[model samples]
Every structure is written in C-alpha cells, then in structure tokens.
Target: MQATNQSASAKPLSIRINRVLYGAFVLLSLYFFLNGSYQDAASNLGLALIFDPFNQMVRWENRPRWQRAWLLVHLLVMAGIGLVYWKTFSA
Candidate 1:
C-alpha cells in the first residue's frame, strides 16, 4: 500500500520536472537567438520540439487558428535564421 502511494505521487512530480526542463530549453533557445547563436538556438528549439511538439506550456493546441499559424511561422523563421547562418559561416 505504501509503495503504491509513493508510485502514484511520483508521477505528477516527474511530469512537473519534465515541464520545467522544457521551459528551460525554450528560454535557452531565446537566449541563443538574442546572442546571434543561431545554430545553438535551432538546436535548443529542436530539443524542445522533441520534448513537447504541441507546445503544452503555451496551450498551443487550444489557441485559435491564427495563433496556431503564427506559431508555425515563428518556427519557420527560426529555422531560416539557422540555415542562413550555416550557409554564411560554413565555407
């Protein structure tokens, strides 16, 4: 019984930890972007996507259609920035 209670409590704690890590990744991506580290920014964004493709923190799926479209546009812009940086610097 004690073990069952402990396991049940652990589930929410694990989810919270995952959300916190996801938030950190998003913040780090922004930091990299601001500092002109496009490659790293893109990498962090990729990690975030892997962790939370639907953008749960932002409740992206619950938002209206236009907002969802804007989120896609934002991701594309980030990808473009990284691509341009790679092309310019990878000679």
Candidate 2:
C-alpha cells in the first residue's frame, strides 16, 4: 500500500508539467527575441536550459541520437544568439 501510494504520486505528472513549462519558456523566449528584447530573450533561454525539457542529463555516449542532436542544437542556437546580440550591441 505504501509503495502503491508512492508510485501514484511519482513523476509522470510533474514531468508533463515541466515539459509544458519548458515549451512555454521557449515560446516566450522566441517572442522576446523577435520583439527586440534581447535581455529578456536571453533570460528566458537560460530558464529553459534550467528546465531541461529534453532531459539531457544522461551521459553523452548513453544518450540516443535524437537527444544528442536536440541538446547540441539548443546550445548552438543559444550561442549563436548571444554572439549576434553581442556583436550587434557591444561596439
């Protein structure tokens, strides 16, 4: 009975909520970026990374192909955006 209760209260629902929150952060980031709010966009991007919607905690070699690609692309995009913003505004 205790095991059943713990299992019933476990992560499935929280995982779903995290995914939703992650998506919202990404969308909000995009919105800020497009609207010329670089600081807010970058902030949201950091928040999204904290949420780690893609669950990239697994070892690099242990992660499947799509997971690796997702995390890599995310980091690359963030870097690219930061570079562009810095170059454009930090003269």
Candidate 3:
C-alpha cells in the first residue's frame, strides 16, 4: 500500500523531469544545427575541451543522467552569454 502510493507519486515527478530534459535536448540540437554552418559561430570544440574532465568522471549508464542536469544548467548560462555576445557584436 505504501509502496504503491510512493510509486504513484514518483511517476509524475519522473514524467515532469523527462519532459524538461527532452525539451532541453531539442533546443540544444536546434541551436547547434541552425548555427553549425557558420565558421564564426561558436564551435563545439571549445565546449568539448572545457567539459572533457567532467565527461571522463562518469560511468557509461549513469553519464547521461548526470550530464543532462549539467547540460541543462550549461545551456541556460551559455545561451544567456551567447545572446549577449550576439547583441554586442551584431549591433
């Protein structure tokens, strides 16, 4: 009985987290795809290099779960910075 209630409560939380993760993935993918063609646009090389140490810290199955949280924060911060860069230069 208690187990059943716990499972029911967890389901909604999991679903909400999953939806946010999917949304972030789609947004990041779109940002990369649309901006990838330009040489002047920010390159993935820098990101890969910067985050390499964190990447190496995780085991395979658990990596995605951890990276998703890391990336969601990263995207929010970087997107804000990127927007500022764009606004500063493109003017």
- Native-to-model Cα distance after best TM-score fit, residue 4 in candidate 1, in Å: 2.9
lDDT by residue (1-91, candidate 3, tens digit) is 9999998888667666655655554455457758764322233422432333343435646777766666566566557657878999999
Q: Every model's Cα RMSD, please?
A: 5.4, 4.1, 9.2
Write one digit per residue (lDDT tens) for candidate 2, span 33-68. Answer: 999997788778767765666544467898889877
Q: Report clash pairs, candidate 3.
A: none
Best of the candidates, lDDT: 2
**Per-residue lDDT tens digits of candidate 1, residues 2-81?**
99999888877767777787788889999999999977887786676444434344575677798587457557866776
Q: Which ten residues in a row have the lowest lDDT in candidate 2?
A: 49-58
Models sorted by TM-score, best on top: 2, 1, 3
Collision count for each candidate, in order: 0, 0, 0
Model 2, C-alpha of 28: deviation from truth (Å): 0.7
Give candidate 2's whole-model lDDT: 0.78
